[model samples]
Target: MKKLMMTATALALGAGMAAADTIRMGTEGAYPPYNFINDSGEVDGFERELGDELCKRAELTCEWVTNDWDSIIPNLVSGNYDTIIAGMTINDERDEVIDFTQNYTMPDPSAYLALSKDVDVDSGVVTAQTGTIQAAFVADSGATLVEFATPEETVAAVRNGEADAVLADKSYLVPIAEEDDSLVLLDREENINMGIGMGIRESDTELREKFDAAITSMKEDGSLNELIKKWDVGATFD
Candidate 1:
């Protein structure tokens, strides 16, 4: 993409901008209400707004860069970007690889969908968004597993009978299922992920603290919860 090529070139040229001075915010611009590529092909969404505010509060110059979800963390570790503002879940497994600021958002509410109740919730052909625990669950559940790049595609898989069911977050699926008569939100639910946080490398303790303090400020001032409500991000700060 134009953004990707431009970012690579800037990094290669050493742009004379110290990496520590101008932070690059990386995201998987595919998940909506979280991060997504807009109609203008620019990254835009809740995470985008949140990241910008955090940068402003931290008094840091920031640039936005989008990457595939599958490679977002690895790329961050590889020094392709300075910070990950993607909606990554904070967990023991990932924390071992990279440090995380305190959670900015709560656990994502996950759900399963099917065409009808007859579609087996278990042991049936299952479709899930790729690079997720849901996909892994399906693969390990003895069901025929199908993976899709986006959450929307996973729902489509069920509609077209490509798979008997789909496992995804409720926030993304609820809007779609409510509008379509064919989509069924199954009773089954999951909360596999913990809270969401900004991913930082182990050595970037100063950078991490800045964002953490900024997040604390927002939480205390109630701005973060307001955004959570406006974006329908479910469960604001207590």
Candidate 2:
């Protein structure tokens, strides 16, 4: 979930330019497994590790840039960064503004989470991160869609009764549900699944091709599967 995008050109104008050789990798350092800041106060998670490897394979110098999820794309277009290695789904709405490398991770399921299993996930109030496919689905489902800026806040909204349920990526909610007896994932699953990919400016076709090749190489060599299993993020890219 995130804030809506501004014009790509306008957003790009707001950000400072990056150097030629160094690709600035932007990410939302809050989502765990997929991405998050670790004890060392650095971007330390699945994407970080995967990103570093991709850069190595592509022979591209890279630097990490932590950003809020809401403005991640706009900032990329504005020139603040070169690529978004965050767990961003490849979807039609987003593809219109920025190009994505071939998917790096397989499609992940979206599920509803609630304090109890009996809540009507289809009809009751549902919360999701703003600007996400989950939020869009909830909006169109006729359920009351409450949106928060962060995934953590969406879960909190459900716990606090501000919303009856929270809809989000199953991998994200799985550990939380396992850790807390009060939280339960509903049986219903939303059909808005999409593979996650790296976001790049549309103008950077050559850069996209380089990362694409790196991703393909990892897939062929089985290193990509290793990372997926190591992080427990989701299934491998097909």
Candidate 3:
């Protein structure tokens, strides 16, 4: 009888813990306007703010953690974090590994930018950040693709003339090109549409559903639109 009572108490305790209503989220904290460390050494960005709002709407406490971009997905799958609020693009390749919430950001194209006027990006040699849709595009297009660890490295390759052009998200590259006159965005006839979404562990369909519902509600109520306008996010949703 004592053993049975103890087991019942443990089960009740476990249930209470599970119903605590806190969601821990992960982000790269290096991707600007999405998640990044500001001058104050604090994480602040569109995704961060949006995640906080979503948690509020869902009546859950949110804890944000900084993670490296390359390892974010792996850590998420390992249960190190409950959800990934990073500006992760939802691609078919990634879908094989993890499930994603309904896309919160609209799809935008990736483009090529170069620092050298004489370099012919049209000749089909380019560098892209590894594991991105842009890298896949370059590979499929038969370009001599050089993979870089980060966007900064890809941009530096272009500046140093080591690469003919750097392919990245147009929204990010456009602001960078505008800031640095040495780089020019190539006028391409084709652009790749990539939708960014929040990631969750494959088994966490319940959490993903909550996120999707919250995002859909925000979108319907104009809160999401207000956030986009406040952050000046380059893309818009239909």
Candidate 4:
């Protein structure tokens, strides 16, 4: 949901979202099925489609902006973007920094990926994307947490034996595990389950309401569920 690129092209893209009627939709453009840069180098994925629809429903012009995951929230607070449509999980810690619209996605389980099912994920070295809840969980669980800048790097750490396992959203890992013969999902203990929502600045009450209403409409009309199933991200909002 977050990635940072300060190239001239990205800056121009950000400027486009700054138009009077355009709501900047910030994302990581690294998390697949959620957000990613496609072959055309444009933001493309589930959140891309969902954000566009939400903006349309809210009667707001919107444009996509990519920022690094580690600085996603900070950039939003700094007025670099109007809202974060990144696949951010709403939680108490995050709430202190930004206000989230009603959740667009239900809670998803985090998973552990390793080369073997029998790996001791609880105590051995684990890799997680920097600035994610998965990293926090590993830190507190007494495991040696190796942080990576991107999700792919986290997976690479495990594959290269730099870490014993990679912990991340199960939705993101399932396909990788299925495609790779050497990787397997370790038996999970009810991992952190949290609803994913769009992050808006704390002071943007009216804007938050606009998005919340749009999300509510999507839920009522069943389009949100269709998108969730289509993207295979996780269960729909309930």
Candidate 5:
């Protein structure tokens, strides 16, 4: 789940989970292997299953909601949902506006997918989803960065020859690379952020702690790593 644009600075959410017993878990519902909408029109993938388990462990009644990646944070702070179980990275920029549970997985390596093995990652046109860390990396790497609104578009840019490569999480791109003979992952990778965690509002300390405890339990019990192995979605905990 490559998430958030960081433009949502001022959030208007008041108290956290005040009126309901059910907590709304917000997700992008598009990033596959991590998250996506299944044919049944339901949220599915590693995060979906992981979120359900965490909610169960926390003894919280949770319902899922879908949001676009660009506005996920703003909507979370605006009270549209109670928590973002959306494979969001925990970082200083994001922590400024919302709290996060302990990381449930290790940092995912950002990998490059190109049309050819000979493409110069440093000098060629590269595409990335707007607001992602991969996009930020491209902006500073001397490559001409092409920003797309969706992850699908970034990959499409490479296929259409609009970009020489696309940078994204390896887990997300690995499936595509295997499915398409035209795409190949470059030899190098970029390790980004503190790893994936559930995002909650700043005021939701109680909720945060609850999920944190649940995550701790999962990590310690070794189930988290098992899930990671099952989905092949990024690195696992020790």
Candidate 6:
């Protein structure tokens, strides 16, 4: 009888240990200012820091994994990650697949970048990553649209004159344009804000609630705002 009790206690202890809190996070780790690999090859960016902070607040161990932007969602659905901390814009289309926390970061309007004197945002054809908001804009405006695999490729296309304009996140383009005098910023006056939130599996309501609480605490304490300013992330959380 004593042996049976001991065995049951051991099993319960093991189960408790297995259920100890740990969170695996996914990010592109290539989108600068949001999340990217640093020169040291470690993930670094506003989103990365925010994830770390939130995990700390929730008393959970965090393990970050890098995945391609296009596959981030699919991986989350497959249980490859407990949550996605990448700079994913929260939209109705995405909500159909996964549940998201409240908006932690807001999106800025997609902007155009082109080589000086060679491209026109209003007249020439513009290209963006296929299935992106910028691509939707191109389709609606009847502009010639080109597709690329990555943001880097789209920017390269503009530089090489393969595409007249590249529409992407303004925060990404502004820094690149400032560094390269050959590039010019277009559509500075447009403001399109898209809310960005953490992605979780459709059934992970418990985890989602924890993350949402952490985010709400961060925003209330001004930590989120400070991180946004420190990183120069294009959009505001408020």
Q: What TM-score against the true fold does each predicted structure earn?
A: 0.86, 0.91, 0.86, 0.90, 0.92, 0.86
Give me the runs in candidate 1 sitting further than 4 Å from their true place: 1-19
Candidate 2 regions exceeding 4 Å error are 1-19
Query: Please, what are the lDDT tens digits per residue for candidate 5 over residues 107-137?
Result: 8899999989999989989999987888888
CA lDDT scores, all candidates in order:
0.80, 0.85, 0.75, 0.85, 0.85, 0.76
lDDT accuracy of residue 224 in candidate 6: 89
Please provide, for model 3 over 27-124, each residue's C-alpha lDDT reduced to its tens digit, 9 standing for 90 to 100.
Answer: 87866767788889878999989998887665567788887776778888876877888778898888999888898887767778987555666565
Q: Which RMSD values do the candidates have, in order?
A: 6.6, 7.2, 7.1, 6.8, 6.7, 7.2
| Lowest-sum lDDT 10-residue window in model 6 | 1-10
lDDT tens string, model 2, 1-238? 1122222222222123433657889999988879998889999889999999988777777899998888999999988888999889999999999999998888889988999889987788999998899999999987889999999999999889999999999989999999989999999887687799999898887678778888888988889999998999888755
User: Tens digit of lDDT per residue, candidate 1, span 156-220?
Assistant: 88998899989876766777788998888888888786888999988777678778888888898
Cα error, candidate 3, residue 88 (Å):
1.2
Assess the local accuracy of residue 122 in candidate 1 as a C-alpha lDDT between 0 and 100.
73
**What tens digits encode model 4's per-residue C-alpha lDDT throughout 19-71?**
36567899999998889999999999899999988877766767899999999
> What is the model-wide C-alpha lDDT for candidate 3?
0.75
TM-score, structure 1 vs. true = 0.86
**Against the hidden true structure, what lDDT does model 2 obtain?**
0.85
Better of 2 and 6 by TM-score: 2
**Worst 10 contiguous positions by lDDT, candidate 1:** 1-10
- TM for candidate 4 is 0.90
Distance from true location, Cα of 197 in model 4, Å? 0.4
